[model samples]
Target: MSRKHLHVVDSSSFELNIPEAELELMEEMISAYEVRRLGSRNHKQKSVSSDTAVIRSFLTFIQKAPWNATTDDFDAWCYQIGREQKVATNSQRKYQSAVQGFYRYIVDNVKFQAAVLDRYNLRIIQLVTEENKIPHVHERQRTNERPAFTHQDFESFIGAIDVQIVEAYKFNSKEFLALQRDKVMFYSMYVMALRNSECCDLNLSSFRSNPNLPEFGDYGFASVWGKGSKGSGPKQRAVAIDHADLPPLLDWYVNDIRPQYLQKPHCDPNEEAFFLTERGSRMKSGSLNYRFKKILGYAGLSEKGFVPHCLRHTFTTHASSAGMSLEYSKIKLGHEYAATTQTYTHCGDEFVNREAVRYAQSIINRLSDDE
Candidate 1:
């Protein structure tokens, strides 16, 4: 059991008596929830810790065990958080997510439900509803959170990584190999706009040459297992890596740089991971994060409230600014809804004005050709 658990009852609240078995179930659910949260989402500590706090707060507010709580109880708890606590909309949604996961465990996990019911004669019910969910306001619009990095900024970041690679090579440092891999990993991410987990999960089989575009070689398409909502599991999508510049970079990395990471004496020749760790195992999202942080630090980027996922935002903004159609960008980014993809776009005024002129000039040129 997590010793970090919080007390769920107060002296002022109605006295509550939970069966030992039921209490144990709650603890177990918390433990399992932590594992599930860490495994699926890239959230490390904040999810498990904050979720536990949210669960404890919900339990304390209700003054009853989870199974005994009703939808009305949950509705009130949400109301209190938003109205009294005045947490930001995003915080409310996080609370929703934590509670939703608990209820899902209670409702879906047959073993958990059976054990609790057999021992305590209690049935767990989902108290959360769509009615309880806070509407998602696009943070890009609202708080100016991590305004998408411009293409120039993204280039600077990649260039900084390049400089580090050169410096490591100059020193003949062992870090040269790892820096080379980071370059490919981050470059692919920027050009293709892959999620951190998606990029981390890449293996040799994830790429294929577009027969029609022989120049791109095996870099024309990338298979991505993208994140879906909780319990939806990962949905597979194909991202088109058709940009002319992207293909050459990917080709260079695959042919030249990737083999270096695989050359250890003990390294398995059959290891198919596109990106390998120092140990020759597949790269993990956390490892990807460390390299991402190093890139950000070298690029002199502010690390506050930013993560590797922001690269996806940068890709979306740059793609839109460059006149990629929303439908094309939506499919490329693996967003199910066009509106969701819009939230990632952060095109600036200059790009908008330049693009307007380009569009006008193209139409004028077309008219001249017609004449």
Candidate 2:
């Protein structure tokens, strides 16, 4: 018999009942693996705990010890969780990796492998094989693709914000000042093509005047720390404040609205953050996402799957349609590659139709002149 067939037959004949001694060995194996990961890999306790949970789940699903788990069992478990539970592809990969890591730990420790084999008469083998495992990808993956907002949708969204602000002010609602801050926050994200974290991380001194753009005063350009690559730190860039209305609005917020936040109880007078909560702390990314979702629903766009990141995509698309060069857009958005900026630009069908009509009109004019 083939080695694989012999092993499968052996695993089949073993008693299904797991003794207390076997359970202790399994727990010991997991604990040793966790210690190795914590010391050598510097994995966080939460991550280690997650790995342990994944191994236990796989064990429960297979109804066998890790040593007796076959590739078929692993594949069936993957299909059950992936198809039935509808887990995301990235999450599926993470779970697969955790199991693979555990098996690797077993294979490397001969003493542990022998302990399990001698006790249970079953040997641990690599379960995650090339044909069965989900391939690791370096590029970021989005399970749900978020579409960019159309111009009408964006206008309606902004109009909703304005209308709510007016109502809040008229009724003297406690959120009146907060709504104003959110308006500026959303506007800045779109106009500057800023990531939500970058917007939330802004401070009072993040903006400064450009000598060439005298009309903008001190609100000419915003210096922000852009999102970095996997291990690298934040990449700093100066995003030019190009919109005519934004500078004045920013000036108004700085002079009028921001001070109100500072006046709250226990607020630090020396706090340098540009956007502050009613509690006087800097705005968090989660809070910004929650607020954006509320505004999206108010604007009747909640069903459209639009997230705050779509604002950055909207900026790139609108900028491209408005005759901004792709190279400039790349620089403005702090993208390392022009191709990355291209991915963000999702122009609508109207822009394409308009360009086609303009091209045909130019051709007709040329024919008339020739005649």
Candidate 3:
């Protein structure tokens, strides 16, 4: 049977002539535009999905207004919705843009009038100004603090995890499968420095055992579907792995744990997800967080203010501490700019002091020779 079609309702008049196919096409176009914002690094699908959600919310609200609604109508709607929902300024801006973009699309493609488009733009600006009137107190407070992690603190955390694993595994009844999985996951996140979503969406098939160019010392690599990769952008990137160092962990996951998990009667091998739950279902963002929290507690680490993204931060920090060049780090992190990678270079004072002492010694020797 054919699926029931979706419709995009015109909020102003409660008109619902938009067909599901048209809505889907419009959503695809908006998603394309959103992915374009990422510049590069291939996260198109994520961007599209985000934009689609934002636009869908805006459309649902807009369709409730009169068909001949004026700028005042749009403005009033924005203020009412913004205040009612207590939406943040950034969120309000997104909604406004979504509404404006939807109208622009209708105008350009559906023969919507210039006047209607002008009204939409005017309402967006008005809403933006209204939203900005509230002071961004939280942002002002956060301006002085950097968002990256420090090398020493990160190492301490890892060391803490190691100690916990030794202690916890001694008493656990479930054979430490979960603990092992978390350790591998944590190591993979730090070693590869993947975004949480990228890690979550990774597929077992993407792990190549005998990757190309093995003679050049190339080892296994993961074909990651990065940001802007879903729609029309770069779909995949081959991230090289130091297989000699990391391969055994992947081997344990794929050959040992994965097989046992998949052998269950209800397991869905075709799900295309690398991570699975105890029930053999595909792992989700929430499950990743739950696992991360459980592991953090087991490792005797404080869960407060700790986020999974910190693993990415820890990777970059440790790499910088090890004297890895910023350019190399940037490339490995899939960052488009050197500055983005620079944020992760929170080296400890000891590193700075050691470098300073070396420099001073070199200067002293040179001066003595000159005398």
Candidate 4:
């Protein structure tokens, strides 16, 4: 447990005439919570800060300390906060979990719970429960609202990028190299099943030739720092680069366009970033989102509500359609479970029916051959 104090509330907004001992106890509790987060949870600074903020906001809303807060207080605060912030149900769930986790930590720690009881004669109980918490059953599972790009839409999107790259090159535009980079970036996201941050964090050393995939040269697989489960850390994995066009495009960009960017006056000679900007640094996630929208507009699919993550989903759905097994797709996408990968597979009803017919035809042909 740490002695560092947490700013639980603004003194000006909510004044409380409390004894020094009680205030000290509250501060100690917050410090201990932070210690648990840092040591046991392995939470990063952003996660720790966000969790603390949520706890502080909940305490402020309840107008009481953690031990004194009740389910009614939690319910009231949850409702008011959700309405006031205009956050989605998922966001509300996160807020609830943060507070809920704090309660759990205090309740489960026998020494801490005993101290609070001995001094203040009060006990903290878990406020968020299965009944009270906002359900994620429908949101996480079932059909995802974030639709994957249909095959035709993907083609149109890539084709539009191609036209932009060619046009930029022909005019000797300053953005010509950027357009080429964007082509590889976006296509790689789709084919490699990369998250936006993962794609941006890529280094020149990330790609290596898979001995089994020698034809792809050194671009056969991309080793990415993948998104982690919980707040653990970056999960690294090698995604196989199977798409034919992807290897050549990536090779061209790396050997040709990438060097040109590195030669910019302000560029760092030793910069290892695979995706470099004109400013001589790694490409930021925000820039990726902005470029994605621009390309979406060019593809005439801007109104379809597609996002960068949708590219991963598009790959999942498209790969399954192209005969990739569910288990293999899960491995390639670095998903923890096959069930999680299943959620990303959003093959249309038409495709399902087509597959059904094809399967039945295969069975019939086999029976006829036996006869």
Q: Pick the candidate with the highest TM-score.
A: 4
Give the alpha carbon lDDT tens digit for every residue of 1-371 in model 2.
Answer: 42222111122333435667777787788899988877766666777777777787788777777787799999999997778766677778778888988999998899988897787777789998767988855222441355677889999899889999999999999879988998899999999888989998999999999898999999999999986542235789999999989999899999999999989679998899888888788999998998899899889989988989989888988998998999999999888888778878777788999989999999999999999
Candidate 3 per-residue lDDT, tens place, 24-124, comes to: 54455455546444554344555555555655555455553222334565676567656665565655655566555545544444322343345443221
Q: Report residue 297 deviation for candidate 4 (angstroms).
A: 4.0
Better of 1 and 4 by lDDT: 4
lDDT of 2 at 79: 91
Per-model C-alpha lDDT, please?
Answer: 0.78, 0.83, 0.60, 0.84
Per-residue lDDT tens digits of candidate 1, residues 263-355? Answer: 889889799888889988899999999988877888887564557778888888887877789999889888878988888888788877887
- Residue 304 in candidate 2 has what lDDT? 87
TM-score of each: 0.64, 0.63, 0.59, 0.73
Q: Give the better candidate number (2 or 3) by lDDT.
A: 2
Question: Which of candidates 2 and 3 reaches a greater TM-score?
Answer: 2
Per-residue error (Å), model 3, residue 222: 1.3
Mark the regions of model 1 whose C-alpha exceeds 4 Å error after superposition.
1-133, 141-143, 302-306, 353-371
Look at candidate 4 and give me any clashing residue pairs. none
